[model samples]
Target: MTSSAENSGQPVFTIIVLGASGDLAKKKTFPALFGLFLHGHISPKTRIIGYARTKMDRPDFLKRISQHIKNTTAPKVKTMLDQFLDQSTYVSGAYDQDSGFLALEQEIQRVEREAKIYDRLFYMALPPSVFIPVANGLKRNCYTTKGINRLIVEKPFGMDLESSRTLSKALGALYREDEIYRIDHYLGKEMVKNIMILRFSNQIFGSCWNKDHISNVQITFREKIGTEGRGGYFDEFGIMRDVMQNHLLQILTLIGMEAPRSSNAEDIRDAKVNVLRAIPEVIESEVLLGQYGKSEDGTMPSYLDDDTVPKGSKTATFAAAAFHINNPRWEGVPFVLKCGKALDQQKVEIRIQFKDMGNAIFHKDVAARNELVIRVQPQEAVYLKMTQKLPGLGMDTVMSELDLSYASRFTNLTVPDAYENLILDAIVGEQSNFVRTDELDEAWRIFTPVLHKIDRGLVPVEIYPYGSRGPKHLPEFVTRFGFERHAQNYSWPETSQTSVAQAVAALSADSKL
Candidate 1:
């Protein structure tokens, strides 16, 4: 546990944000740092360095990003904003050159020496194209300090397996895996982190979290908004690499992995690697791919229409795959992972399905099943659907949900942002919240073949209208793995849910048209 004393201890650190003026740095990266300050998690002596080509001075940087912070966070965050502003210094420079790195290195030294703490942390918030160059420059210029805890890199880790491997190797040449924090914001989500506790910490889930009692798993990451002017980047990467491989697969690993020997990062990550290593070697015909067509509404942009994207792009906006872990715990059980843009709804979830009623004593006439859902986005909560006796009937089984919502349950506690938790973890040398380099490579390996198929148009990509459940073939997609069109037996409840296999089984039955 991060005790109050630990949280409040040691006030000195030189924290540098390399791409200080970009969208991620302004909207998410900067605000997350402020959140740590607000919650008293960051040390008081932590000095922030904003490094970028943007030739802005301190006053301009603060004024511009302050509004971004406040808009993205609560009004009470102003106190922390003032404190962060006091320590923020703007550095104008390019990422590729040595002069900038030299000047930046001096700035870090000045901060550490002045603040009386020798800790140095550099955060690369720039685009992936610049990650390797900046990383190389940092190794050449900034990694000279002693006893530095860690260096953190944000996600979109790499394009695919090869690129991820190259990036990991490049970074490894700079810092050890433990000394490098690869941030996957989803892994930082309160709900995503809860997956472990929900399974390991609770006996109810721990007992059935294996093949014998559970059936299959579904992890979905969907966004209702189009690329929103990020066409160049979105077109190049698409949903498979952007959403499914890292974020969605990380969630699935949490759900399907055996309990680690210990909760430490290495042990936990080891379990995930084993599962990822067992990805189906045979041709995975069960996978479904797609690009979203323009909406009949005439308001959104289609993949081809986005001028920033290359013409004749084969990139897919939606992707779904049914995979299995060959380990004893989840051997034959299917773990389905799916993600897409322009979805009918905004959602991130894990659905767990328990075995179907072989022969039910109660309401055998009605379909009966039990499921659990852990909803991750829009709102966060858990829901359990099980058969219950209809009040007026003689043991007639009807499905209903028992719900728990974090918003309503934990009053007065606004959970720290994912970046806040992850960044602070990196600051304090806790690797539990960040993914390892091996984990990133393993993640890409699982999807490399499929991604290539998607890129070359070797695999079929069914285009669906914007804001639809995604290719109408989704029901058939799950059926190949023995799942009926979601459990006709259940429907979701409010705050109301997220993801898991049993929950999807219950949901499938109710969703069958």
Candidate 2:
């Protein structure tokens, strides 16, 4: 029982998950904990306590969380899961009331005493309405003084700039800046984490990461499904708040930030903050908003079709905006952030389109500009779309890729869930990947004006078929920002019937003079 403390010479770690009975907890939080335990990132003595208002027995609670964990026939997975469940227990509690918090505190104390645990992490998976109350309750009733106490908060941090600052002010009073982890799960993504390394560590990329060589940068998040039954929640925040504001903007900072002085977390965040400060507030004219309608065949439902949605709701399920950083490095280049639910496919990617080859030997139509694409999910990949001669005897040029598809390259490794990586970072006190207070404030500043406009019916919401790409003007909108879409057809070789090795070899052969 004390082996974790004995082996590591460190105190046991405990994670107290608020809103444990909620969907986010069961689907993401617990499964992530199981991942960390399976990977041996946490001490075996680690204790997981789930607190929520719903009353459920230990067995029932275990059943709910375990449902989303990977289903495997492997005995090791099963054993690890059983052990994870063994270390976890549930407590019923009201978020705001003192009585429920007192019960939660007692249970936590019992675990700490039994396991000799000293550290605690509270993950808030509840609605934003309950965030303040739960934070206050934990601070008053459950905060541990003997060891580290960390709080992990999820977002829609607030509806807008004023609200975000208000929430930050309240939380700051309760917890020191270092003790709070504002979770923006996108920061935990494999590719997003790789952005810094990809830019600074590589000379070829580092040399040209500027307005002079790069035409435009696009950070896109697309979902194949709509809000489903969560229209009420979706309507309030809309796509601007839900996806573009936090997740996509976080990606932009990583892409646009200068190299940090050192690898220290604060230095890295300082670099990101500088990027945020350079970005001006979004202009409503530069933004295109859209809400999904029924699919072409009328089989799929629209955003307003959900009974939970208001009849005249104009909440945008799709948003595309052009942002310009006024810094010397990226003065004129547009950083376009596009996000939509109920689109053609599910993909999250950062597409950096380099300036068209100038004074080139090839005809304009023959060569497409080099594009460095980082596909973040469904199949993680970082591929460069470059020009090459067709493999045949002809001089015709073709677009090919220098691809590093994770599936093809890292065949044996399984990428950890975003939550798992972030939760582990919180336990170890790493803040580089988490958003800071000032970073949150700056992010809100960029989006608040446009958000307010949309809320007040000043901006129009275009409607597109649910299964289609997005608003019909999406192509034109992106084009307006100087993002050129090549007319020639190009596809990622890794997705085709040809193997990655074969595709790379063919490209190598074609490149020969």
Best by TM-score: 2
TM-scores of the models, in the given order?
0.90, 0.95
lDDT tens digits by residue: candidate 2, 309-378:
9998988999999999999999999999999999999999999999988888877778788999999987
lDDT, candidate 2, at 138: 98
List the global CA lDDT of all models.
0.78, 0.91
Model 2 deviation from native, Cα RMSD in Å: 3.7
**Collision count for each candidate, in order:** 25, 0
Lowest lDDT 10-residue stretch of candidate 2: 1-10
Q: Which tens-of-lDDT digit does each residue in 1-513 have in candidate 1?
A: 232224345544678898998888888888888878777777777789889988988899987667666543555665567778988888888888999988888887787677765666788888888998898888888874454646788888888778888888888887877778888888889998888888899998888888898877878888897776688988878887788778888888888888899987788888887778877632448688888888868776687787787887778888888888888888889888888888899988887877787766544346555678889986788988677667984756577778887765665588768888788778777787688877777777777887777677778889888888888898788767755533344556453223344566778988995
Model 2 CA lDDT for position 390: 85
lDDT of 2: 0.91
Query: Residue 50 in model 1: shift from native, Å?
Result: 0.6
Candidate no. 1 TM-score: 0.90
Cα misplacement distance, residue 297 of candidate 2 (Å): 1.4
